[model samples]
Each structure stands twice: as structure tokens, then as C-alpha cells.
Target: MISRMFSRFNISIGSVTHQIFKKPTSLSRSVIARKFCNEIARPENFATAGTMNDVHIKMMERIGLEPGYSPIPRSREHLIQYQPSSADLPPRSMADSFTSAVIPLSSSKSLQDLYVSYLGHVRFGRLMQDMDLFAVWVCHQHVNIPNLDKNIHLPYTFVTIMVDKIDFTDFSPKGTSDIRLSGHVSWVGKSSMEIVVWLEQEFEGTYKKITRALFLMAARNATNTGPAPVNQISPGNEHEQNILIGGEERKKRRIDHQKMSLLKVVPSNYEQSIMHDIFTRITRKDTIQLDKRVLPANGKWMADCSIMNTIPCFPEHRNAHNKVFGGFIMKIALENSWVCAYLHAKSRPKLETISDISFEKPVDVSSFLQMNAYVTYTEMNFMVVMVVADVLNPTGGRMTSNVLYYVWKCNESVPEVIPGSYHEMMWYLMGRRKLNYALGLTSGV
Candidate 1:
């Protein structure tokens, strides 16, 4: 059976072109020509053999992890570091056109005018498995900052999700919305620089803020030799002092325009840079692996928060301060929970349990959020959507919310990654992938 499954993946040199939305027709199969046996397919039982496992684990980490780091968020204020390398960067591609989408027509919409007014940064979540693999694998390429002439775009496979900023808070699929997405590179680089991008939405009569990301690039060598040394800034540090001094930022200011300009503004030392450090060039990438995502709703309600019923983020949904009230988010979340379970039954299922929910944090009125649910663990006759609601920052950065909802998947099987032959494929299947990587496995599943 396993052999049969693997055979489906084979591709011959001379085969027919693939079709649209259908698996390919021709696949080359090989015969091991051995006898059949009943045993586990996994080569190593990761449980025992602590010593050997540790050795292999280190080796895997060395090769498995990408080089460079998550790019640093530009400081509202400060001088950053720099890295240098090839100047040419990958270009960004945009949609030739977008389809018209209709949002709810409301009379009393709070912040309605501002909901999706101005646009900036965007990161399309995973669209499919292979694309997701490529997305994760390519995080290390760097590009210059100032020369980052256009938007910073990267592609990943996903189903339905749009995270953006709505006035004061971030906006997501709050109410009914039709969001179309495609993929391409906004910026490409070898080192010391990268282009960045952002996005927003068009709704009713306004456009909203999507997300903004920057890529300060640095060039890497088989060995290390460049305009400046690499910066190793610690990521996610609110403190300014911990930032790296050399990488993309340094490369940005190093451009003299002339080989030996009359004036050289960049200091000779790497530590002199106050804005960036090694950590800064490292882009903070959120990997959403479909399978590794465990919300723990066994036989519980499940809603693919990315693209389900639009949970409104309006005035009636807010409090006295004009901010969207936490209570309203909770109420709507729970109600949506029931709706998800009902959908799972192909109509409606018995609402056996909510199991649990937590408002991890206040989901502001204008905040853009993407809520995804899953049945992380299960027991016979019971399952749930371990719900997760995440907030997106104006710069297209995301933060976890104070809320969590366990939607029930009343009638569903233990989910698994759509299987593939690559080690990366198995890794994702085994839940070894990242959180954002699972955007494709929605409640619709």
C-alpha cells in the first residue's frame, strides 16, 4: 500500500503537461522487486536511542534550518546595522486585476469609514504544501533597504485569509468578504539588501491597512568577508540596545553612489550602527504548518477562522471608548463556534460541548485578526477545534491574542497533513511544521 502511494509521486522525463486543479496524469513507477513484510515504515524510532538521536538531531538542525534570520522590524527611531553582497534582487509581481467583493451593507457601522481606508504591508499565508515548503526554505535571501524600490512580496500556499490594519486595530475577515490572493516575489536578494511590501483592503467604500514588512539584507559568503561584519541581533527584543549592528541597514547607508565618493558617511566599524544588528536582518517568519498546529478540540466545533463567517468588528461590537469590546469578540467567537460545529455535520451537529475558550487578550475593534481552529487531540466520539485568533500589526507583523476558542468537530477524523514523499512533506505531516503553515487546513476541511 505504501509502495503504491509512493508510486503516485513519480514523474518521468517525457510526460504530459499538468492540468488545472487536477493531479497530473503520467507518473513513472519503479519496482523494488523485494518481498512484502509487515513493519513500521519510519526508519528510526525517535523515542529511544537518546545519544544517536541527539547527534542526528544536531545534524538535522544544521542543514534543516535556514541561514540568516527573520528580518528586523524597522525601528520607529534609531540607526541599524548592515551586510553586503550581490546587488541584484528578485522583482515583485502584482495582480493584473482583482475581482469585486461585497461586504455587508450596514447603516450603523463604527469606524466604518476607517475600517479599510489606507493600505500597506501584506503576507499571504500558506496557499498549498509545496509552496509552503518553498516559502520556508527561502527566508535567508537578503536585499538592500533604501534600494528596496518596491513592495516586499513573498508567496506561500493558503486557502482564504487576509490580515490587515483597520484604523486603530487590525482587520481581518470580520464579516462576509470575498478576498482573492495570488503569489510572487516583491523583493529578491543574495545579501545586504531586500525589497519589502505591504497591503490593505477595499470594502464598502473604504480601504484598510493590511501589513507592512521590510527586508534589510546582508550578503553571506562560503566564508565571511564583506563591507561589514554580520549583525546577530536577538529577535523580538523591545529593548533597542540588543539590536544587531551589521546587515541590511548597514548596506543601505554604505551606497556611496561612486566607487570612492568625496564623502563616506558609513563608519568603518560594525558596532557603530545603532539601528540594526544581526537580529535585525533576520526576518521574523511565522511558519504555519497545517498538521503541527494543535489546538486540541477533539470531537469539538471547528471553524477555519481564516475564511469562515465574517465576525463583524463594528460599533455595536464595541464599548464606550469606541474600541471593539472584548465581550463582543468573545460572544461572537462562541457563537461562531456553534456555527462551525453545525457546519461539520454537513448541516447541524449536536452541540455536545464548547470544551473551553480564552480571550487571550483584548481583540480591539479595529484590529485585523485571523482565527484558525483544529481538533488537536481526540478521544472516541469527541473532538474539538482548538481555536486560535491572532492579531496583525500595521507592519504586517502578527501577535497572539488573549482569546482562544475550542470549536467542536463533532464528526471528523484525526486530521493529517495531505501526505507527500519529501522529507519536508513528512515533517509537515508529523506536525513538525510551523503554525502559520497550516492555513490551508481550514474548518472547511
Candidate 2:
């Protein structure tokens, strides 16, 4: 059935043109933390202008950082890049240039300068991107049928946008950033929609526009769109296509990523899946590596690998100080790995300890971070996930590396492991474990 969210909203596509975005210092962790400390050291009871000051309060107490944390700010910067209605959009399919360049983004630019300039513009971009995406969803949800109520309802983030791909102009400032995003969506299934996102960069303004990408997203028919069946996008096809799928697709039972619903508030797993989709869709990655784990009946499991992008990083991924926010990356890498582990563990096992995890170098928020994870040991109902981070640079050559380690316990709580699945699961886990160990990857927390 057409979603209610789609049914209630108005359906006219609109645009805010010739807009600019400014970086927000308050959006950064360092700045937020500093402000958080100054405001309320203990981070006790507080109010954030009201809705959920408590969540932020708890966050500060637990992580000693501001509870106002949101990756939305980074996403906000992304909105401005859209071709405004009054502005010109590239005519060619936007799939040509594909490469990542590493450049210095934190050139001692003060947070005040970055914030004043970036955030101010960002607000405009945010308003524009959101309005456009909303407009598209508003229009599409109507099915454009007559006799329909102009009042339509769409689940939050229910619209899907795809236009002919256009040639991308090198937008990253020299010595500032090395990444730009490529977006592509095709009309797939009747109700299901598919999108392709890639991250690319240019250093000398000389490299080929792009030839590779690895990112993609799937949206179905709901308040939130589900996987669509478009000929142009194939989440399963890695080598030929240039994008990553945000949600994981499993055979027998649906993996958490694929099992999304907006009936009651979106499920947590679904939310994560959607978030991944936004990032992948925004970046337009060519290939994506996912971290996964599984538990078996006889003794086996498998974990999807991490996503590695040759594309340079954008300022959005960095911090006010320009350093790749270790915590943010760590959380993303870890959470994704955990989800992969969950996929591998069909038996629904419990969490175990995180093996040795370490960060090699300080990744610049502006440089791309190549990350991956894997699992091995089916019989033991155990899996180890690893992550590798490579920093991209436009001039000095790629130079930084980081890694993560995740350990999952197959049968910690249950006495005999699940009813009839332990034995077979053991076999699978053991085989995967061997493969993971052979890779000789570094570990991380």
C-alpha cells in the first residue's frame, strides 16, 4: 500500500537556489565538549531548548562529551551541493570522474572562522537539501494520481531522489579536502527504489574525472522507501557497479538491514541501516565493505568485510580541529562491524569482548578512511572483526593507517547453544575464523 506519510504531504518539488554553506564549530566534538564542560561540568539535569536535553545530558556524563552530538551537521554541508532549481546542473551522466584525493583541510583555521563561515552557509544548505528531498518525496508519494488528497503522509525520510547522473566538477578546495560525492538512483522495482552513491576526489585538477565508485542504498515502499528494482543499480554486483548497499541482504531470514519498517518508530537496527544508506548514498561509493558475523547449527559463521574507498575524505567527516574524529569513525566502524557480526550470527548470540583495537595515525577528517572487518571460527561460535583505515592526501601521498578488532561470543548465555543449531553453526564459524586469521589484519577497540 502507498505509505501514509507519502499520502499526507504536498507533492510539488521546489528549490532554494544560489545558496552557500558554512561549517559549524558547535557541531564538532572538541568544541561541543568544551562548551559542554563550561556550561555544566557534571552534565547533570539540563535543558536543550527542551525535547531531549536528558539524552544529551546522559551522553555527556557517559562519554564526557556533548549530548548534542549529531552527524546531521556533516550531512547538512552535503545538501548545499545539490544543483538548485535556478542553478544549472551538469548535463552528462555524473558517473565519469571517480578518484579520491587527500588534502590538508585543517590549516590552522580557527573554530570560530570555520563555524562562522561554514555553519552560516550550512543552515542554508540544510534548508535547501531538505526542502528538495521533501518536495520529491511529496510529489512521488502521490503516485501523481488524480482525486488524491493533497494532504499526504510519508514516514520520516520516506522519499527517494534520482535524476540522470551528471558530470561532477571538482568541488574540493585545493589543500583543503579531497572528496566529492556522486549520486545515482534508478527506477528499480514497482515499490522498491535503488540508489548509487560514490566518493571521488581530485588533487592536481589533472586526474581523470573518475572511473570507479562503491556506494549504494535500497529503499522499499514505506514511510521510508525500501529496496527498489532498478536496472541501473545492483547492490549485489560489486565489480561492475560503482556503489554500496546500506542494508545487508541475507537469504533465509531477513538481516537487520533489510528488515526495515516504519510502523512504530523505526527500529534501532533499521535506523542504523538508514544512516548507513544516507552516508553511502551521499558519497556515491563504488564498492562498500560491510562487517558481519553469524552463529551456526553445526559450527560455522561469516562476517562481511569493511568498505574501502580510494576517494579522498570531505570536511564533513572531520572535526573543528580538522583531525578525523577518532570517536566518530570508531563508532561507525564498530557499529557496522557489529551489525555484520549479527548477520553472520543467525543463531542470535550475545555480545563478547572487543579484541585489541588500535588507531595507527591521526586521520585528517578531510582524508578518506579505508575501513574493513571480518570474522572466523564457526565451531567455537566465535568471530573476530578487523578494521583498516588509510588516510588519503592530495599531495603528500597517502600516509596514515588505523585498525579495529571485534570479538563475538556464539554461545555465552544458552547452556546448549540454541535448540538444534549449535553443531552446524560451529562448523561454519571455524572455517570463517581460519580465513580471518590468515588475513593478518591489525586489531582495534
> What lDDT tens digits, residue by residue, belong to model 1 across residues 27-77?
222111000000111112111212222322332242232223223311211
Assess candidate 1 and give its TM-score to the true structure: 0.25
Worst 10 residues of 2 by lDDT: 244-253
Candidate 1, overall lDDT?
0.29
What TM-score would candidate 2 get against the native?
0.26
Over 155-237, each residue of candidate 2 has an lDDT whose tens digit, in order, gives 11222222111122223233233323333332233333333323233456643232111111233232222332212233323
Q: Estimate each model's TM-score.
A: 0.25, 0.26
Least well predicted 10-residue stretch by lDDT in candidate 1: 30-39
